[model samples]
Target: MPSLRHELLAYAVPRVRRSRELDDAERERGRLERWHSGLDRSLPTRLVRHLHQRYEVEVDRTGDFPTHVLTPRTHDVEATVVWMHGGGFVAPIDAFHVRYADRLAQQLRARVVLPDYPLAPEHTWADSHDALVEITARWTASGPTLLGGDSAGGGIAVAVAQSLRDRGHEQATGMLLLAPWVDLTTSTPSTAWFNARDPWLHLGKLKAYAEWWAGSPEDLARPEVSPALADLAGLPPALMFCGTRDLLLPGCRLLAGRAAEAGWPLRYVEEPGLIHVYPLLPAIPEAARAWRTTEGFLGRSFG
Candidate 1:
């Protein structure tokens, strides 16, 4: 059974389906590109104000990305979390991303760094992968760090970790993924089936973005683009969250199984009736519960 809040929250998102009657692909792409540019321009001001209420925010430009370091209002910051913002590889970072990073930092007594990575249509995975690899590598080198992100960012986090592992470098102490879209190809049965129930994700829109992020079919099969096809052995312990109503749930299930087979410590929590990236939305009660679970996992992992 779904929580009352979760059930009610579904109604807030418009039930806009992909149809030829609405618009064409070019129009959709233009709209998304414009929206991403606007959001990128607007997020810094809004996020700085919101994050300052809880922590000191430091903004630094690293290569092609802008990194926001959030040091919480605490004396002992035990760890560092390099959190990636999810935008389906096309959308812009939102207030929810900032809030989640701030709250998670506070909960774990850790400093959080959120990076503004390049998005699709304008930029592809190739354009942003090396920068993320460098960022995660630098942070993980200092000590044990938690690598985290939601949706496309989650996928990026995993890809970065895998690259580091392949290079014989330990990248992440632990990984926290929120409704990660591990398989960009969406080759799973549930990916298509769950589209009807998932209010936030549309298969058609997702396919378009996936193509933009991954330039070719061969690119989709690359481990850096889709972690589902990557070897997972010897990586850090992971905690993953996904909702049954999310289009990516099936891929997560496959990932859990693959991790188990590879002897990786991956704790996958599938919420029965929740939506995508529920924890990012603080208004929902499930978000609190998810945060509590994440905090507990971090505590035990650190201990």
Candidate 2:
């Protein structure tokens, strides 16, 4: 017997998880090719198809890993934000993640690149990694680079940061993660607590994404596969926000503690009553606050 809000969140969680199972995102890769069919395709030939429909942000097609840059026409553009979309590892950059990116890009006054990184079951998903690496390498030699994303992409951001560190590049200024899927292993109390309340996502969907993205021991332990398990030392500071209602909250907590113990400034936000990547829904007041908080965190000096 959960309370009403608890019960509603609990109920909403499964619908969200089922959306993963039934929607194009959680849709099994290769099981269906493109996320949208020709008839389903839009007049605008690109990732942010409905950009015109959205009045606030300016979207441009950047041909790298099917990436897009979302910027505010009126802003100063102080920094750059690279966004990775989350769908376990099987989903594409859907509207939910896009809205978050647009809002962030506009608010932070930073040029933002949102890459629709390939999902699993594709031979090229790793190529998506290479794509990110290539792009990041270009930025590594420069000023403050902020890496952010939701779910799997957030994990990828961590991996990207780690990759830079391993290469001795030290380019990233900070990481902003939203309920990031840091652990492919998926072992945590929150995972089980939100097990029933997450509006979308479940062990089965999680397993499906994992099966497609990783196989064998090497893959499982690969730093990119689960940065939560990866050594958190020497990484830059991070602001990781997770809802108390998300299964991945534990992952966020563990990674934050690991980073802090390793002596990096890792700020973890646990919104008391929200669930997975709640910031995506900008219409929500909490989501708006999250964006403002993120801007404040990222607005400071970065050499």
Best-matching candidate per TM-score? 1
lDDT of 2 at 234: 80
In candidate 1, which residue pairs get closer than 3 Å at backbone N, Cα or C atoms, i.e. clash? none
lDDT tens digits, residue span 163-210, model 1: 889887766888999998889888887777898888778888877788
What does the lDDT come to for candidate 1? Answer: 0.80
Candidate 2 ranges beyond 4 A from true positions: 1-64, 71-76, 301-303
Which is the leading candidate under lDDT?
A: 1
Per-residue lDDT over 1-303 for candidate 2, one digit per residue giving the tens place of the 0 to 100 score: 224554465566557645644344344554544542222211222445555454334333453445565545564667677877787776566766665666665555667677666556563345567667666656556555678878888998888887777777756777788889888777665667666666666666675566568754357657878888887878777888887767677778888878878887788888886877877753566766787778788776353
Residue 149 error, candidate 1, Å? 0.6
| True lDDT of residue 74, candidate 1 | 46
Candidate 1 residue 155 C-alpha distance from true site, Å: 0.7
**For model 2, the run of ten residues with the poorest summed lDDT:** 36-45
TM-scores for all predictions? 0.91, 0.79
Model 2 clash count equals 9
Clashing pairs in 2: 12-199, 13-198, 13-199, 13-200, 16-199, 16-200, 17-199, 17-200, 17-201
